[model samples]
Target chain A: MTAPSAVGISRTTRPLAPPRRTRRGSRLRYTLTVLAFLLPSALPLLAFTIYPMIGAFWTSLHSWNLIGVMEWVGLENYTTLLTDDATRRVFANTLYYVVGYLPLVYIGGLALALALNSLIPARNLLRGIYFLPVVTSWIVVALVWRWLLNPSVGVVNAMLGGLGIDGPGWWTDPYWAMPSIILASAWKDLGFVMIILLAGLQAIPTDVQEAAMIDGAGRFRRLLNITLPLLSPSTFFVVVISLINGFQVFDQVYAMTGGGPAGSSTVVVQQIYDLTFRYSSAGEASALSWLLFLLVLAVTVIQLIGQRRWVTYA
Target chain B: MPERIRRILLTAVVALGALVMFFPFAWTVSTSLSPGVGLDATPQLIPDDPTLAAYRELFANTPFARVIANSLGLAITTTALQLTTSSLAGYAFSRLAFPGRGLVFGLYLATMMIPIQVLIVPLFVQMRSLGLVDTYLGVLLPGVASAFGVFLLRQAMNSVPRELDEAATIDGAGHFRIFARLVLPLVGPALASLAVFAFMSSWNGFLWPLIILRSEHLQTLPLALAGLQGQYTTQWDVMMAGSVVSVLPMLALYLFAQKYVIQGVAGTGLK
Candidate 1:
């Protein structure tokens, strides 16, 4: 009985020991290697992302300013922001911007990318021209667009006048300011979307298009049936990036309008900035920022969900 | 006849689009060189009297050269740092089998979604605590190890063959040696693209520097240009000159690296 039991134990133990030992060692090495690789970014993320996020949250629950005594205010800041008319209008303006600006940018980018995809002379130059606005600083672009849209002296209105049409006061007028900002922002973001879409277009295998052509499909038919479906992955990418960017639209508005002309162009980010930096209302600003964060997260989640139905990775 | 008409129509449309796209830059240049008050009148394609007065004023009244130098310095240094840090991490992510690697990378990607504006207050606080405010290092440090850069380079590195690494290893090379001798040379184009991207982003950065920098001497070109616009009213020529100064370096870089730049943009989906 002892000999039989010992033989069974030895047979079982020999097979298991090597794999278990190797697994433990490999896991340990992998953990160390990953940590080593991540150290640089991890440190900053902790300092800048995690710590600040936590600090901002804590600050949002208090009434504190630079060089002032801190006082805990509970949820008063949140409640006040919810009821305030000015704050409400800022949120509305941001929503209006998101609704108005995203379509122009996305559609314009897609059209341009498609058009550019066809063999054209000076395609490189054309791509450069389209992308120029993107590399230019927002401050400079804002200033230049402002100059170009100046009611009396601007070239844009001058061109309209050449056609015997009137152009609105783009920046000064309350009614036209948000639209003007949107136009400028769209121009800036157009190149970005074009690049993404172009990448998508390039990734679509030529065989599919050839097959469609062999099947007697016209160019439009091919694009509608094959290219568009295949390009959905990139399109989905553009949609997600654009939506996230649209929510964080700040620089152009800040530089050009400053949420002026009866606060028509006021966006939530601008309001958060003003509250925290300008007015020293850290608590309220933090609340507003968190709200903005939640909105962005929700939109991102929606896009992710939609992507399953629409996006074709290959 | 119909085909000719279609070709002509397409050409005309494209030409018109190009002109519209380029008109603003042309106008800015024309206005910058215009002699006097004429620029403030109805904008024109050609300046009535092209003069260098604005350029003279731009250099005279402001630290225009210094501001440009500061921008170049920050951009170059940041790009260099980003390339080194991101490439190492990218290599590790691509080749090394590390525990929690997927979880760590996912966390890194998640940081990309966090709106930068949310970080401003806390970043400012942290920088102030470290006494880094008003310094170039402060502006450059936080951005050196970009998650996007790491992700991008890692994606690029994945395309490189494993045989090369194995060959180098068999030749008595260590991990770092194999990386330096074998991997670095193969991914040169990708690295170049990343460098250009990193440079442009750093050069055009506004809000972060605007918040951190207070001293006039230390201000970047955008901040300086904004200040110039605010200080002088109706000095369109001078302002335009400042704008040209700010844009010229970028234009020069773009013209020189047109091929690589386009390839980079097309490959990376960078704006």
Candidate 2:
């Protein structure tokens, strides 16, 4: 009887162990299925994004024209870019654009968002109207702005003249070239900023606003105290995105001014393109790109750290 | 200010701002329609002698039509590829249980911060080495795999009920079948939102195309438009006409799918 019972237990345990093995096999099958699903994106991302990123850094270390053999010159490209006055000016120009663009676009967006958030007739229509530029390509906007700000034949100065004010040579003037870029950039991006801020505004509970109202908080005071503090996340987003984009400003510069008027408006990206394609200095271009990558990464990290002091999650 | 007065004042200001914002577009259309070449001192809101001469000249003389077709074809292909890749990866990340999923998804997210400017040099080298320079595939391939699309779709897919997938699994449905038949239909809005973004980004893409496609016939709209401006700096009407042609399709798409576009943008920041 004891032998028979032991045999019965062994038989039951054998079936259970095999089932466990089957479960393990199924897990392996699941992983294979997952790989199949991810293959389309993973292959491209590895080939395009991941590999290129590493390749960029590697290429930065080597001096090579697109056509010629790569010569390993460790850190030489980076050193040249650092000491080069023209490259220095390009980075400064990019920073200047960010400094000018961030505030104008953010403020303009905040204004529009606040207005749209209010009770207004044709709200969507008004929002869409303001957002017209956001949908158009930079080239189209840049072209329009070139004509609109044409020193002689453009409508902008023409209108300014009608208002008893003389408008300066916009894209032509070295002093105004970056400002001109900022203006067009701000114009195009305001709608995007507005949409972000509007979403932020709407997320704030009305009860919070009403509570402030019941506490006798004035409209301006509520906005400054209650609204803005709560809206910091979106504001931060607008700033960070605007900064990153401002650094990469190219299409407008390419189409509108071509980084012209003595290279006053030449930014990092324009320099990168010219260095590679125009000048056939791929190593320097890669080096410059990595520098920009560092700049953007540093700024974004700073913003993220700084947000902890001001951004209220709730 | 009184409530009524404040409301009226706000309305007036908002309306004025809207007009200011819309003025450039109105001016572009008017300039394109105007008969003469350069702009006048004061822009004509409505051109006195409105004609389609610039449009006619643009389509007839230049490769504008071919450029448009190239742009349209490339954008469609890019968008389609992006959707397929993104949705599949999104389903894997959100629904499928697999080892190392978190790490892989983290990689996907991290790539979003790496701007294209950083990668362009190496990418161009890769394309050249592959002998894909001046090809449509060169312009189309790099943009087809979008990290943001995957992230967005994953977010959308996550909200889908797990019970549905489990029930399908119990009913002997495979992951692919469940993904296509069940999860996908539920995430239609996200797919649309991603589609709009993909299309817009591809259509507006300039830098890669500018670098990759050296041939005149291969030029996308933005590249061709930039070239048009370079060649005909004084031809405001034709430039504006090219501008109009470049901008109209996007505007029409935006108007038709305004909600999806706005949702895509708004969703991004909040995320």
Per-candidate DockQ versus the true complex? 0.40, 0.57
TM-score of chain B of each: 0.95, 0.97
Clashes of each: 1, 0
Give a tens-digit lDDT track for model 2, residues A1-314: 01122233336433111112335566466556767889899999889999999999999999998887999999999999899999889988888988898889888899989989999889999988887788899999999998889998788987888899999999999999889989998899889999999999988899999999999999999999999999988888888888888788888888888998999988899999999988999999999999999999999999999999999887
Question: Each model's TM-score, in the order given?
Answer: 0.91, 0.95
Clashes of 1: 1
Candidate 1, position B203, lDDT: 85
The candidates score, on chain A by TM-score, as follows 0.87, 0.91
List runs of model 2 lying over 4 Å from the truth.
A1-28, B39-43
Tens-digit per-residue lDDT, A46-147, candidate 1:
677778888877877888785477799988888988899988898889889989988998888888888777766677778788888877888889888888
The candidate that wins on lDDT is: 2
Sequence-dependent TM-score of model 2: 0.95
Cα lDDT listed for each candidate:
0.79, 0.88
Runs with alpha carbons beyond 4 Å of true place in candidate 1:
A1-37, A214-219, B1-5, B38-40, B269-271
Give the alpha carbon lDDT tens digit for every residue of B58-86 in model 1.
Answer: 88889888999999999999889888878
